[model samples]
Target: MTERKEINVLNENVARIEQEQPIGISVLGPGAADWEFWLTSAGFKLANQEDADVILWVDPEAKDFPAIAKDPRCIVVGNSKTNALCQQKKITYVKDVNDGEGIQRQLEEFGRKTRETLENPTLAKSRSLTVPPALSPQRPEKKHGIRLQRGLIKRHLPPDAPLEDPKGELREEFREESGPLSRRKDIIAALPSLGEDERRLKQYIQEKSEGEYRVLEVAESYADLIRAAEKGFFEVILVHRELPGLERNLVENLKLLREKAPGTRIILIERQSDDFSAMYKGHLDVIDLEWQVIPELPGHLVSLLKGQYERQPENHVVFKWEDERKPVTSLPSVRTSVLSPALIAYHSAGGGVGKSTGATQMGFVFAEMGYKTLIIELDTEKPSLLRAVGAAEDCPGLAAWNHSDFISERTAIEAIRRTSRQVHGLYVLPVGPISPKKVVLPFHLEGLNGGEEENVDPCQQAAVFYSAALKEFQIVIVDTNNSCVDPPVFMALKMAKRVFYVMEATKVFLDSAEAHIEQAYDLGIQLSNYRIILNKCTANDLLSLRTITQTLEIPVSLQVPLDVEGYRLAAHQGKPYKPKTKKGISPWGEFCQNVLQDLEVPITTSQAKKPSLRNWLLGWKKKS
Candidate 1:
């Protein structure tokens, strides 16, 4: 039977199954990009979905889908969940038949089988599916026509294999072909006395690029690859499984690339099957480019490219400013204007300073200003913002997880709720009570937690997890914890285009915040950041701000007085709290507006060097 006919029969069988049973279609993970891929490719229609008896569940991760199997009518699949289980010795599966003689072999075979299935109604409905090659790209092979044939492998694989045999022919083929057997044996029995003649594979390494095989080196670090990107190298970046000093800024590098190299294509390569794809799905055009171990060369170049890089092969075009080739290093040095710096940080200092309220309102301002925004409650322990906004929906975070029903672990982006606010583009993902014990980060790296100091370094850990996903949205606001000392808090802090130090109108608050600000600066944060917003200020705070600004020699960004009624109403409604009245700009709003103005690139004359408020105040005094 041909491959085409086989796939067709599968679709027909599925249709018949859905008609015969109470077929249900359930989504296991958040935003599986390829549901449409499977829906269209597999030839399933939604209108028919309601009537078709069987359930087709497209999950992002397969691990969360075990219970769905219990239904007997539903089949769940996602690369993440499926691959992880395969590694842990769960399911038995293979690819969609090998097309050794080009796609011609597979296509022809599919057509034949599909016709046979339709003609003979006796075939079992649950026919086995050959797994698609691994999600990672298959490496290229040398000089296409020739392939290594292990006779032992032939012994294990039957004419048309059915189910896997434990001690059967397949095991011997694996051992003899590339497993323990091959590694222990020498290349050939006949060779010169000298070792060079015997170590032929090593010789091929020197003349590597000349062979039909190709090299796929995953870049070592994000920074190294980003630096290479700044210089415009668009090849695959080699990344190491582990490294030091990589704990750096998140959005800054991506921001720089967007500014310098917009729409750059990045391919992620990992040493483990549990790679960083789903977590950073929206951020990259292709997440799992391919997978391989350290210091080991891949076997087939053709498989690697087809599996990975082929998905997104585009040459990027970056916007460049007109620069006359003149050395003006000594000319009055001026800074280039950049996009508005959005601040996404915990509002209150240590224990107080209105952290939740500050973040809550800032989220409102960002959305109102015509920017699509998403605010995640990284403040895992307190879980105030969700309740404050009535988004709590009366369920603990655990309530959202139908562990058995979910096929893949969904990201916060998947579980967010859209709010009914004037801010048309705002969305919220709230934090629930942290699992009493552990925090599971994206990419399955264990031991990172919040609500207190995190065990994993935030910036480094996030680079491995979050930063890649920032590409998906226009802007993402993270309402984090109060402890500036926490390394991972920098994970959110470093991603910020600007960081606001929210302090109360007291000498003590200012003093405490200065220390945190200093720590950020020392730990690779730029100093242009570090703006101060005095939250919940009173008349006394006005006096203190004045005295402190003069003593500290730093400008105060804004002064927001306490508004108990305005905040409490929205908090009770579980809606984002924003001032109803356009009522002359609160000091915080004005500061935010200024940031928006400054971020406008190629600063217009009117915007740069506008008369300072201090000067306007002086002029008013003179008039008086």
Candidate 2:
């Protein structure tokens, strides 16, 4: 009997080496999917055929070869006899496609050859397998080769000099260095502590430039930081992202620093694990250094001072219109229009569950009950709200948010009022018309154009939107991202008064739900705020309601049955599921009603009567 083996086990050494120097391989045709997990685990990036360092031809017996396969960099992996018969050279033959270890060894060897070929052409040419011709001749790109003309250089005095005032003559000769004093690039650092690490940083800088270029001061408090900034003409101000008091509002402090030190460049220093980029990364520089690599901070500062460091590219938002109108400086206080409006967020562990469906249906029911409701789409990855409502994706929605950092409560309400489409009486704030990949939440617009005020903190923006939304509507349903906990979803969880943890009534999804619920709690969301909503419950499902509730260790708030036909019918109409008769309510509606009663949400009478039979059938009535 043959021993069973786990496929695609990660090779740590290979993964580490690949991380240091990635190998871009393009796996072509048919069986490409088979190698994806293995390649990804081994830290190999899948690139396009044209840009790939190596081309992998999955189809062994293919007569018609892709144009890229003709390159010397292409490696054919298949049957030796078949490859030989096909007249291909430099083939890697693996007995079984499932043998991930064998494939890893071969690819590692090929990557070494590719690296050597680029490093030394003579060494690469002696080997049977060679890298692509284009990459083979060129050396690796220089990271820190360019050095700016900085600091001072001691000059060798000429043998002969003027007879009169030699010291004066020498002083006149080297006047350029003496004039303006050529300041030694002072720096002010504001870190969480001014302990041994801080002293060591100062010592390192002094040693690097002989005490000339060094940290002039270190601030331990927000007050000290602002004072340091205002007092010094420092070239660089390095502030910790999570500096004690600065955590409350980092951007506000950053702006203060920018104002205090006009020409000084501010750089935010953070721990490697921290990601403040999803928050405030506008026009400022940020560096994420490992805690162990704190000693290297001096070197990085020296490079910055020398103007040789390659800083991260700044994200610039270019507006479509040439209007030079300044953005809203600050958000206005939200006047209490509706007393404590219900803020509900719907989330799930994985996609393909009825998370969005549940949110929309609940919002629809609220709207029908004479409560003004707004369903905010927070699923940036793949927003389905617009499509679900039969509205054009190009309609103004989240795109309006790109305008300013501090959006007014009125502006938020106005943007939704003007851009949003209403179905029955439910208002939907749609995701903008663009590829989800290019869409950045909180801030950071990739290809989109806007004003200078871009990339505000996700939490800040969400707060702005939420406060604004609450002022206009009695019920705000936030349809969050499915599966992963992104920044938007995190903010949604924090902001929501009630969280609906939606999941399918299946073992696989139930397990996922348990994991996600734990994760939500780990992220500091209150367990008491969450309620499990079991969706797609079938009549003969293996697990009963009692079994599911017991398995998850949480009470199931609602168990929505599998209603594919009803969903399809609703989707076809670009609306939520409705009742068959005027006096009756759908199952989803009943679920919403029960939820409202449980939450103590007031249900008022609808202002408008049912549409005329002619209008209902023909849709002759115009939208309000």
- Top-TM-score candidate index: 2
- Superposed on all Cα atoms, model 2 deviates from the true structure by an RMSD in Å of 27.9
Estimated TM-score per prediction?
Answer: 0.36, 0.42
After TM-score superposition, the amount by which residue 372's alpha carbon in candidate 2 deviates from its true location, in angstroms, is 1.0
- Residue 498 accuracy (lDDT) in model 2: 85
TM-score of 1: 0.36
lDDT (Cα, tens digit) per residue for candidate 1, span 1-624: 566766675566445433322112332344333243323222223334333333444332445456544443343333343445544644322222221123222322343343334444444344463222342233222111111122211222443342224543222222222321111111111001112221232233223322222111112234333332332212223232332112244223333433322222222233344444343334422222223332232233223423443432222311121223222122211111113334355545565456777777666555444344556565555666555643323323323422121221223222222111111124455544324543332322333254223343434544432342243234466676776545446666776766666677676876776676566668876656556777776765545666767654557777776777666765664444445343423454555568666545222111112235455344323321
C-alpha positional error of residue 508 in candidate 2 after TM-score superposition, expressed in Å: 0.6
lDDT of the structure predicted as candidate 1: 0.39
> Mind giving the per-residue lDDT tens digits that candidate 2 earns over 229-323?
54324556777665656767766666566555544556666545346555465423222111211222443555454554665322231112112
Alpha carbon lDDT of residue 151, candidate 1? 27
Q: What is the lDDT of residue 577 in candidate 2?
A: 70
Off by over 4 Å in 1: 1-343, 392-424, 433-458, 464-466, 551-553, 576-589, 601-624
